[model samples]
Target: GVSRIKEFDKGFQEAVKLAFNTVGIQNAKPSNEIANTTPKTVETIKQQEIKQEIPSNTYTSNGVKYQVATTGNNSFLLINQDNNKVVANFYPSSLPNVYHVEVISDKGHYETIGYSKDNSIIIETKTGDKSWVTTTYTK
Candidate 1:
């Protein structure tokens, strides 16, 4: 039964390759190719280091770095310098965080941006009046 199953699998693979070839794509691989493939050595793996750059006019507070760019009055964009992505948005609010801008919002709704005890940045977005979505960014 094991040999029968192996034969079925091989036939199915051949059928798939034929179907791919009919569509002008070659889905063929020699059995030795998989065994001959190169593996990553310790030296190759060590070359992959985390890359990050802090642009000018960045804000650093609580050991977290952010590229702060003001978009409007009392509104600024918070870009995670290490990740190079817009992680939080700051808006005018009576209440504030360590950045001390005011309120934080994602899409015109009130949100909160603060640091946790571990020194990571935390962003809490309010989807509704009593609902919140919290996101934490670790350095």
Candidate 2:
């Protein structure tokens, strides 16, 4: 289990770094080459697939079920089976004006998006703190 945990941490860091680097390099790369290129290997193709964002069925956790939806004015998150949509708001609590909202989707799901701050949410898949990753956007 320790080895597996180490492996996952390594992979997670590599994946995060690769994502940041890709964003930085994307503009510098020729658009025509990027647009026309095909995946050279199955692994590359899979990576491409993983980068795509797709909507999933609604879900919840513990005693609550939830879904994230967007309207013209605001992003809404509905909690419980009642399906009441709450307007997502961000303001900093205990840390200046920086506010954050955290959402954990159904288990086994990975999302790089969060409200208020980019990647500021944490999801615990295991029984420890290491099960989650968080990124906070700083002003």
Which parts of model 1 are misplaced by more than 4 Å?
1-56, 61-64, 94-110, 113-139
TM-score of each: 0.29, 0.23
The top-ranked prediction according to TM-score is: 1
In Å, residue 19's CA in model 1 sits off its true spot by: 84
Please list the C-alpha lDDT of all candidates, in the order they appear.
Answer: 0.53, 0.40
Candidate 1 lDDT, 1-139, residue by residue in tens: 1122357778777777776777885678779977776667754555554221212265665576777666754455777678776756555433333332234335444445543235444556556587877565454
Regions of model 2 farther than 4 Å from truth: 1-56, 72-76, 83-139
> lDDT by residue for model 2 over 68-135, one digit each (tens)?
45332232333334646442322223332233444444444333334332322222223365565443
Pairs with steric clashes in candidate 1: none
